[model samples]
Each structure stands twice: as structure tokens, then as C-alpha cells.
Target: MVRTPLTPEERRRGERLGALLREARGGRSMIEIAASAGISAETLRKIETGRAPTPAFFTVAALAGALGLSMDEILTRCAPEPDAVPLAG
Candidate 1:
């Protein structure tokens, strides 16, 4: 089945994820990171610039692992909120 095009919110979240990764990857070479993330340098470059909004799961998993970001943190950060809710005890 064909996947629907990403909604505006999804696109924005992807942009957010890209931004976070870019900031966390400061001083690191794109080629190195992308290879470690099991993706192409071009793919990583596009994602970093928000040109590639929707990347594959495994690709994200690799990058997230390398970046020390949990999936929950990525999702929470990518989404906009008036105030962030701290995890409950």
C-alpha cells in the first residue's frame, strides 16, 4: 500500500528532529555519522537540512543510538507544546 504523504505536523516534527541531530553532531563529519547510522552521506545531509523529512526506522534507530537519544525523547522534543511535561515519578 502506498503511504500517505506526511502531514504538516509530521513534516515539522521531522524538521525538529533534524535540527536536534545537527546540533548534537557538532564538529562531527557527516560522512562518518551517516555511515555509522547505516545510511548514505547524502541521505544524512538531506535529513540534517530537513530536505529529507521522513527517513527509515532503522536509519533513525542507528542515528538515535549513536546520538544517545531515546525514541521517547526524540518524539517529545520534536513535538511542540506550551510547556514540556516532566516524566512522572
Candidate 2:
């Protein structure tokens, strides 16, 4: 089945996710992390660069496990806060 294109908001969320992953990675090599996650370095690279915005669920789970991050923590960090209010000009 053909996948639908990602909306702008999804792209933005993906960018946020990528940033969080990068921060969590710290000084670790990408290859090492990818291997530990049971994924190819290229796949990890794409996700980290936001080239692969919507990764498979299992892939994300594996990455989270390898990085010592909880899915809840990842979601909390990547998702926008519902209580955030826009500043009035």
C-alpha cells in the first residue's frame, strides 16, 4: 500500500524527535548505536537527519532501548506541550 505524505506538523515533530535522539546519543558513534539497535547505520542516519521522518514502531522501540531512553520520555520530549500558550504581541 502506498503511504500518504506527511503533513507539515508531522515533519516538525520528526525534526523534534531527531533533535531529542541526537541529544540522547551524546558522544556515542552512530554506527555503534545502530548496531546495538539492530538497524543499519544508514537507517539511523536518515532518522537522525529527519530524512526518514516516520520510522517503523519496532525500529523506534529498538532505538529507544539501545539508547537507554523510555518511549514515554521520547514522546514527552518530542511532543509539543498542550499547556503552552502563545505570547501576545
- Report lDDT (CA) for all predictions: 0.83, 0.89
lDDT of 1 by residue, 1-89 (tens): 99798877778878998999898788888888887887889999888888888888878889998777898877778866455678999
lDDT of 2 by residue, 1-89 (tens): 99899988778778888888888899999999999999999999999899998888899899999999999998887776466688999
RMSD of 1: 5.5
Ten-residue segment with the worst summed lDDT in candidate 2? 76-85
In candidate 1, stretches whose alpha carbon ends up further than 4 angstroms from where it belongs are: 1-3, 80-89
Q: Tell me how many residue pairs clash in candidate 2.
A: 0
